[model samples]
Target: MGRRYDRLIGSLVGTCAAFAASPAAAATAGAPHLDGAEMGLIWVVPFVAILLSIALFPLFAPEFWHHHFGKVAAACAAAFLVPFLVVHGVSLTIYEVVHVSLLEYLPFIILLLALFTVAGGIRLRGSIIGTPAVNTGFLLFGTLLASWTGTTGAAMLLIRPVIRANEWRRYKVHTIVFFIFLVANIGGSLTPLGDPPLFLGFLKGVSFFWPTQHMFLPMVVAATVLLAVYFAIDSTLFRREAPRPSDEASEETFGIDGKINILLLAGIVGAVLLSGIWKPGIAFDIYHVQLELQGLVRDVLLLLITFLSWKLTSRENREANGFSWFPIIEVGKLFAGIFLTIIPAIAILKAGTGGALGSVVSLVTNDAGEPVDTMYFWLTGLLSSFLDNAPTYLVFFNTAGGDPAALMGPFASTLLAISAGAVFMGANTYIGNAPNFMVKAIAEERGIAMPSFFGYMLWSVGILIPIFVLITFLFFH
Candidate 1:
């Protein structure tokens, strides 16, 4: 009992120290900023409430989290603002560095929602893609495909089928856990499209193909280890199933409506690419015209594809899969909160990387001839689990910019380290990654209660962390 108390105190002290030493803990060099206590009140108060809403309030306010995620997210925003005001005392100076209008991260959040909604709508009936035989194969495909479709896209495509194939198993959390470990995190380490950090590198003059090269080996190693572990765990759980009735067997069916929905999806991608390529050719430089066009095209494509998928796919498939926008809506609502609440935190990070905070070595070379960054990749990845990986990636990218080694060969190794850290570690907690909470909410909507935030961490510590440590020592180090 005394040891436990001591451990708790040590944890609190460590947290306080981390907060005090955080690069974003202070204001820009020239400006006056809030003291540690004031910053603590703003960030910590709302953070504690979020933890309460997630872990404790569910006991009393059964519907509270689902019904009021927007409120909670907004409360976080208010927390950030109130302290900003207290520090500045009604001055407009806060506006110069922290712009509330910089809430441009919203559309990307929406894009994730729409993208997942479409993925959730797709299900296969006795399809090869959804079969247990193809489990390892599809996972690899999804992992490789992530660079093009995005990590969330690959996860959405693969998760349902993984669940379907393992439906008969009683101990199925193992499957979901492994799925989160691989499909959601490790699979997306190869390219900018696969994960957000690589995307930031692309925007900053790193070639599109750079991350893919370096990430290949690490990704291969991680995937191999995870697949082997999954197979062993799954083998232990796989049991003989009682035969289903003939009528139940005959009832199952699946197919896409036509090729149109697929075509529509293709068109959206093409339009986005064209918008990006043609931006420089246009007379007026409308900011993010590519993004605007891409969004417009994407929504139109999704609507058309959704209709086609509904009309073309078998009615039985729809019946078996009953419709619910709740999953997507829940993601929408929850992400709204995450987007708003974390904006200031991200802004602070960006500000610090832009010279508000003092400079520190972002990267270092280890004994194994591998280059590693302290602030650049590891920290970016650590935060990416809880925050948006995109912004997290940007923080590191911005920090590493202008450093010579950042420009050269085998940069993908560093990129892979960053990507693995961000994508995989997100499974450490329910809120670690956007998809973790969204997936949990979706599963619960389907009547499967995922582990709590800390409960999930047990898996990370016992199983995943050891794997990560191996990765760090063997591959990344």
Candidate 2:
């Protein structure tokens, strides 16, 4: 792994230098911006390749992918950068790289790291028998907690308990799948801290409580329906299965260990809120990407919070929780490539009527140039199912007109559609959200048999799709 990582880094550095010295680098210093309208569909190959590598590689080549996924991600990024350099020149390539790194990837990974670290430190000390009612309670608790601790954080905190409770059950895959639906995705729709896409909206000048106010009804409806469905299914499954002999030995009471981490989790939330609310209007420009004072402060504080959790928490606490760094590392590496390769797609989407994907933009607007709420909901949700939701949300947000004030006011329904789509539809696939994969990884490690990529899609299509359709009719329409 070390050798592969080194080679990948070396290749990237060499590629950057080679492009920097090309004649086109100097010639295009002041040329007009590269028009997305002029680009062909072929430019999107690397992006597609990276997404395919993520979805297919783990299922087919688990051993090789586990060891060298980072290398694969780096290579995919280089695939985009190489051709991008040839066509757009070195300066633009460098700018885009620096821009994504500073504006998107760094802040994203930092928050995930903080949440993963802090949540991993805290362990649920007691276990319960996997009763249908108890399982429903856990799902409900996680759904509410997700809006506060983050979907990733809440999923990490509760998944182990859920798995342990159901370890002896023969039909438990459904439990884990529903956990992913509510805890890992849909439950995060109500707050910026709940999901990265909403946090990006907050950074773009949307108010901190805007999601809470606008998304409350949709979130409540989704969570209630999922919980009710889960309870009914679990009750039926419980009746068909015999009780485990060891179930009697497990404790009925629940308690939390590593309590300090709760304070740290709160600190993580406070840090995020502070960054959004305490902006001093100070910023430093690095390669045309603006790093704001509050953002830098927030990143530093998050790092400190992560470090303190690592230092203060007992090793036993983490071990009991089955904590490892691999999940976050996987997310960090894969999303780095995602953030890089997505540049062209976002640019093309931003080009509106002039780009190759102009039809997509046209689909969400009416003949009179008005944004259609249902189209915004489904289009944003569908794209977010395949692409990373944060950038997908940004694309549609801009498509709906990127004014925070307007989005919060007269265009509030459109903003709500975009938010609900990005957050809820992320459950449509395992790769839709970062924690979805992490939860699957941890479950598989605990000896639970998770579904394959397409198998999981079947669950989403049967369950979540109908719920979304209802949402479209009830709210979006």
lDDT to native, each model: 0.47, 0.76
Angstrom error at residue 92, model 1: 6.6
lDDT of 2 by residue, 392-418 (tens): 786787677667778899989999999
Candidate 2: worst-modelled 10 consecutive residues by lDDT: 9-18
Task: Report RMSD for candidate 1.
Answer: 9.0
Backbone clash pairs for candidate 1 read: 257-312, 363-373, 385-432
Where in model 1 is the C-alpha error above 4 Å?
A: 1-62, 82-103, 127-134, 141-149, 191-210, 239-254, 257-259, 279-377, 385-391, 398-416, 437-455
Q: Candidate 1 residues 331-434, lDDT tens each?
A: 44443343344433333433432333323322333446344643344565566555445444544443333221355444645555555666666556554544
Candidate 2 achieves a global lDDT of 0.76
Note the clash tally of each candidate.
3, 0
Model 2 regions lying over 4 Å from their true place: 1-34, 243-247, 251-253, 447-452
